[model samples]
Target: MVRGKTQMRRIENETSRQVTFSKRRSGLLKKAFELSVLCDAEVGVVVFSSRGKLSEFSSSSMQRSIERYKSYAKEKNLKHRGAEDNIQLQLCKQEAASVAKEIQLLETSKRKLLGESLETCSTDELQGLEVQLERSLTNIRLWKKHMLTEQIAQLKAREKMLLEENAALDRQWKEECLQHSAVSEEAAHDDRTSQHTEVETDLHIGLLGRGRTQCLLQA
Candidate 1:
């Protein structure tokens, strides 16, 4: 019969757990010894029990091996951190490029909606087109209203100017009429004085003629 594979979680029963720990520890130490002997390598292993008991295997001086391991770990961490930083920089660049492309696409869509382009627009874009058109129409109405109000204000100003001009002209006409009336009255008075003087002179001449005729008849 074939044995099934064992799962790697902790054994729950206290006796079973202790038995498993002993067997695994011995196997691990044997493997470390064999690796050092066969390959002429520096080998080190450390294990800790649940109760904090320490176990270790080393092919050479344990203290020297631990110091070497610490230096190797520090150098490896530095190299790996540099590589991770480079990777993060590349990711940031790619993300920026993607965001720029998205902004460009949005700008193109806006231009299309503003009547700057009709080509390449699809039925899929129609939903956004309606919203754009509504906003455009509202702006157009406001602009038209502003222009109309300006025109009305200009007309009102022109009306006021014309009324002022007409009033000025009327006042000038009335002044001229008064001056002409005075000139006419002065001319009429001069004509009446000249006519009265001429009539009196003619009557004086007629009386002299009658006096001369009566003196001749008496003689």
Candidate 2:
């Protein structure tokens, strides 16, 4: 029988500590053996003393018992993990289904927003939207027409200005040519008159000198 309450702390005395360990080790091995025999369970236990000595217990051959225990524990862990994975897979499927439903609802809402829910639309609403679209198209066409008309008017105005400028330049050029021709003619006439005047003055001087020489000979 256990005598007293086991202290929670480690025993400070080496002798007490060794005694406690020996007692616990014996008890654990005995319980393990009884459990295997009565419950048809497999068991394996191993211990290392402070001095590096090995002790072990098993219900069957130690290798067989240890292998069996490992196999049982592995199967239990695998089964538990598989169950958890199945639950997670189910949750994922449910979430995916819910997300798909949400996406469908959003798609429907978007269609409605885009005015594709014709069955739910009233006649007035449909007519109003149609009228608004027609008015918008009319406004756009009118803007295009106005732009085209303005562009044509601007081109016509530019053409008219160019024509007027061309006419003015032609007229100015003709006037300049006429003025230049008239000035050239006047310069030619002035040159001929100056030449004739010089010839007449020379002839007069020659004839006067001859007449004076003849008068001196007669005297």
Candidate 3:
């Protein structure tokens, strides 16, 4: 029969737990010792009991082994970080080179657009450039026509508004002139009535004086 795998878990019985700890601790320390001797490598093991009792084994002095492990771990971590930084730097350089090449292509295209440096262009390239230019010119003309249409519509609206405002101002001016003319006619009528009343009063006084003088002469 095939042996079953042991299901590892906590031993609930206190006595069993202590027995397991004793056996495992001895086995681990023996393995560590054997590994150190057989491979001529530094090895260390540390164990703590539930009551905080310590057990340790080392191929060399425990303190020296711990210090060496710390130093090696720190050096390995630094090397890993440095390698990552180098990879990132290489990626950045590659991206920069790609961008530079793209910029060069754009500059060459721009020079072609401006009709500069055409001697090296093949006939097919020149024909393609001509087609591109024609397309660009067509697009530009369409855009300009659209813009002018919008401008003309705006100007027309503005002119209509101005004409409406001018008509309103003219109506207001005509109303004011009519009011001024009516006021002038009323004032002139008042002046004429006053002058007629003064003339009639003077004539009446003159007639009375002439009658008085004739009566005195007759007397």
Instruction: Give the lowest summed-lDDT range of ten residues in model 1.
Output: 118-127
Q: Give one digit per residue, the lDDT tens place, for model 1 in 1-219.
A: 999999989799999999999999999999999999999999999999988999999999889999999999999999999999999999999999999999999998778876777677777677678887898899999999999999999999999999999999999999999999999999999999999999999999999999999999999
Score residue 80 of candidate 1 by CA lDDT.
Answer: 100
lDDT for each residue of candidate 3 in 1-219, tens digit (9 for 90 to 100): 999985788889999899989999999999999999999989989999998999999999999999998999999999999999999999999999999999999999999989999999999999999999999999999999999999999999999999999999999999999999999999999999999999999999999999999999999
Model 2 bad stretches (over 4 Å): 1-3, 38-40, 118-219
Model 3 lDDT at residue 21: 92
- TM-scores of the candidates in the order shown: 0.46, 0.50, 0.68
| Predicted model with the maximum TM-score | 3
Q: Which candidate model has the greater lDDT, 1 or 2?
A: 1
Residue pairs in clash, model 1: none
Candidate 2 lDDT over residue span 165-218, tens digit each: 999999999999999999999999999999999999999999999999999999
Using alpha carbons, what is the TM-score of model 1? 0.46
lDDT score for residue 2 of model 3: 100
For model 1 the local lDDT of residue 140 reads 100
Candidate 1 vs candidate 2: the TM-score winner is 2
